[model samples]
Target: MEKPSDNSGFVDSLEKLLQLCEELGQQIDEIGACLYPPQEISSIEAALEKIRNIIDVLRGMQWFLRLMRLGGLQGASDAFLEACNGLRSSLRELASEISSSNTADIEARVENITLTDK
Candidate 1:
């Protein structure tokens, strides 16, 4: 079987990351309706921290991909494959973190979206 190209992997990773981010944003909006009531502020802060970390990782991966392309890695399929693997790992990590949040409502909404897209 032909191995996947790095560019394709990177693209897939980016798209998945974007979907996670959009869902997280929607979750934040939904949860914000509940008056934090001055006590659960810490939880809100912690959730924001996780969101920030995911955003930073996604941005860093994009930057690294651009650098690799500019460094002439584009012509080398092996190099591209390596880059793609790295991006895939990062994306998967972010997805795991998002899942760990246990935002069932958001998860359901995302699932519904996936179904509708089909």
Candidate 2:
């Protein structure tokens, strides 16, 4: 697997990280909420363990996205795959950093979104 080019790809900001958790919920059914506050993580390490689960879910979604691409959108799918690949690597790095308590590797990269309410 290709490694992330840099360490700046991790989703920073706890709020944004929660949102990504919700996105993961799309494929796994409320898993983000289920594994977090509502479920009560026992410790920081437990939280990191949950994150590893999210990474697995995201990787699965990438395959699902690849399988769903239509022929008419071949180019679009290719580009999307690039982003998906990047996310997987990013998540992997995040898991590693959290597991080892190495905040040094942390980088919060929000999705390309602008919140008007903010």
Candidate 3:
């Protein structure tokens, strides 16, 4: 089997990340439509807003990476792409869990997500 090029691997991971983001957004919207406490809804909305900002930053970084590739500089290195793929997998698992969970369980599920630099 032929090995995939670095660019192709990065692109595949990026595409998956975007798709997962969209899925998570839809899930959040569905949750919003349900009758939850006003405060919980507000908190969810705030979290969604932060997610939107992160997506925007990702888009900007994607463009920057593309420019770097075009300029003959190294784009995302293997380690970076691996990290991104790991994140995408984690997000996918999170989405799966959220979708399987009841409305009341969502807060608990969301609370499980934590950010720590490796």
Top-TM-score structure, candidate number: 1
lDDT of 1 by residue, 38-107 (tens): 3233454555555556555655565646755777776653454454456446446534645565455444
User: Top lDDT: which candidate number?
Assistant: 3
RMSD of each: 13.3, 15.1, 11.4
Weakest 10 consecutive residues of candidate 3 by summed lDDT: 34-43
lDDT tens digits by residue: candidate 3, 1-118:
5547856766665676677568657746654553243225444445555554555555546654665566676645334445555655654664465557666677565556576775
Clashes of 1: 0
What lDDT score belongs to each candidate, Candidate 1 first? 0.53, 0.47, 0.56
Candidate 2 residue-wise lDDT at 51 = 54
Estimated TM-score for each candidate: 0.38, 0.35, 0.35
Across 6-84, the per-residue lDDT of candidate 2 in tens digits comes to 5233323234446666755463343233333333223434544555566665545544345436426567657655755
Q: Score residue 7 of candidate 2 by CA lDDT.
A: 27
TM-score of 3: 0.35
> Relative to the unseen true structure, what is the C-alpha lDDT of residue 37 in candidate 3, on a scale of 0 to 100?
35
